[model samples]
Target: MAAPSPRPAGSYGMDASWVPWLWAAIGIVYLVLAGFSVFSWGAPLWVTFLVAVLGLAFLAGGALFWNASAHGKFLVWRELLDELPAPARVLDLGCGRGAVTIMTAEAFPRADVTGVDLWRSIDQSGNSPAAAEANATVNGVSGRTRFVTGDMTALPQFDGGSFDLVTASLAIHNIHSPLGRRSAIGEAWRVLSPGGRLVIVDISKVDEYIVHLRALGAALTVRRAGWRMWWSGPWMATRILIAAKPGASS
Candidate 1:
């Protein structure tokens, strides 16, 4: 068998075009809050009130940015989907813009698919509930797909061992730290049934990926694919890591 070609580098990264507008908005908000602080000078009541409002705004904006980037990465879901099985139950973790969720439904017409995400308007991209619904309908697989808005760390809506496959494409790298990645992996493991499989794709190094999977009690297999290969084999290059839950007789 021919070796899979390596996926293109530099195809991943955040778009910076909106940075100017974002900064401008933040600057304007800061100025408005500063004026409020000046007017409230010695009045402890106004000072505390203004500070709290500004702090909350900042927190909300930060969250919006994070969500936007997460949603934007949904553009790459098609590449990840090629590795999954047909007629399988699929759970898309951090499914922003619902791209993979919809794609999975379409790719496996008999499968039941669910997409879970926080669905912040700013980060939703084309993977929102509405988008997922629309895509599924257009692809003639609406009946098999559902999109839900919720927390990824605690997926209470889903039952344990519910899905045949769990996918977290370009999501693991967005986690804040190593510990956060482990937590997310643990959650993925918890939801997978015995004999279920997981595929996680991120910009992370293979070693880091292995460590995280090991921590979650998963075995790992990595491969790459993309366009412009030697053409003796698979042209698509990707870093694919496949893991199965322990206790399977296979």
Candidate 2:
């Protein structure tokens, strides 16, 4: 594929942009109520002060959510990218709009990166295979990257032991069930070549994944991703799980 003119690479777009918008909207409603309480409702001073403070807190929370989605997640991903060894074939699960996909392609210039997704906008804002492809073009990695419409729970198009590196970022949690997430993780492990690495960054149910991978005999290490990955606050912090598939890569 011919590479399109390079756009400034920072356009990863926000994850679930409506979340922050909703938080800010609620904050505005509270602020309006706080003003009415003090001016017309004739409420007590402490009550109005409390309402105003709550409004500000919600607004701040929204800002943090927006920051994490647009910039903070990428910060954490960049660090993870640096730590990754170069792979000849990379597969990214649920790669919404190519944020992690394009980054991996750029990080490993020789690697052929492929992103698979269901293109559900609920999981991410403006998510589509076309948008992901366009993002790859914008980042000048179109030549080496491809996006496909597929479910992580069942990737029948790919053969077993097809990839050297498999990655997922805040994606498997969308499965919404322990069994479904386990199936997705199992597929990821299945596609991974012997001695390959599977990296997952998720906000919930990572322990369940660890348990499942351990059952598959994968050597695993997991760590909290820290403040840079906090979606809304520390309570929603993400975790990274790295599982090394045993044996030697042919």
- Relative to the true structure, how large is the alpha-carbon lDDT of every model? 0.62, 0.89
Per-residue CA lDDT of model 1 for 163-203, tens digit only, reads: 88898765566566777666677788888888788877654
Q: Against the correct fold, how does model 2 do in TM-score?
A: 0.92
Candidate 2 lDDT, tens digit per residue, 105-153?
A: 9889999999999988888878888888888887789999999999999
Q: Which candidate is the best by lDDT?
A: 2
Candidate 1's TM-score: 0.60
lDDT of 1: 0.62
